[model samples]
Target: MCVVPTVIGVMSGFFSLLPDLLPMILPSEVQITKASDLEAQRGGKDAPMIRQGAVIGKSDRMCATVLIAKPRCSSAVHHHGEQETIIYAASGKGMRHELSPGDFAFIPPWTEHQEINDTDENVVWILIRSGPEPVVVYLTGWGGDEAKADSID
Candidate 1:
């Protein structure tokens, strides 16, 4: 019998023993980034998907950014190593070809994906990753031959 699954299940459920403490935020520890102050961070040499407005970057286990996708734009193929991501469509019609505003999508670790906008309207998504910093590994193509470049720094 496989004991790995049993062990992992038990370990993952450890949080049930303790109460989730999100309501205990301290006033001094709260940090806010204004929309006008959002920084412009870049992606890979070939992948320019980042016209992003970074919000909660440098977190110990999460990074959040507002991504703006231009009309008729398709980003390079890439994957986040060991980091899962959750995307929330904040605005934009999303139309019939994309995620509508208020929609959400989750991407697992090491999953190869691309952000594509095939409509005439711009799309905006809030990207949140489970990592202190994003680990973008740009690829040549789907099921890429190998990594073209690794890590964003």
Candidate 2:
């Protein structure tokens, strides 16, 4: 029996075309700069302002959103479905677990929780949750003021 080489094509032309077939990957530094530029364009001077970016509206799978919260800003005490979540601190400092960065606590389903940004700089974080859809019902604080009862329930 004749054995054939297991290797694919080793042509120089094919190798050179690899980059063309694949999209160029941007470094993290470049990505951070781009994000900063976008934020700068929409950023405004105001107290307790929220800049929601990405994954708005309704969807089936888990949703992802970026929340840019300013100082003294807080999201009222609320609870959602039996969905698990992880809030990642993207930048700046904040009081999540009544402490600094990497000090987050688990919030069980239907458990009421609120986040406040006490620092001067804006606190950016990613909210990730897996479920049918997130339905946050505000009981007290800022959520009680703006959101409708029907929307939350």
Best by TM-score: 1
Cα misplacement distance, residue 17 of candidate 1 (Å): 15
- Clash count list over all predictions: 0, 0
Task: Give the per-residue lDDT of model 1 (tens digit) for 22-109.
Answer: 4354233667776666543544323424456474565678988777776777766778889999989987644233688899988899
Clashing pairs for predicted structure model 2, backbone only: none
Candidate 1: C-alpha lDDT: 0.71
Write candidate 2's Cα lDDT for 19-100 as tens digits: 6665455322322224665466465555364545444344456665566778777766676657776677777666446635
Candidate 1: clashing pairs of residues: none
The parts of candidate 2 lying over 4 Å away from their true place are 1-53, 56-59, 102-105, 141-153
TM-score of structure candidate 2? 0.54
Q: How many backbone clashes does candidate 1 have?
A: 0
lDDT of 2: 0.61
Which lDDT values do the candidates have, in the order given? 0.71, 0.61
Worst 10 residues of 1 by lDDT: 39-48
Per-residue lDDT, model 1, residue 105, is 87
**Residue 27, candidate 2: C-alpha displacement in angstroms:** 26
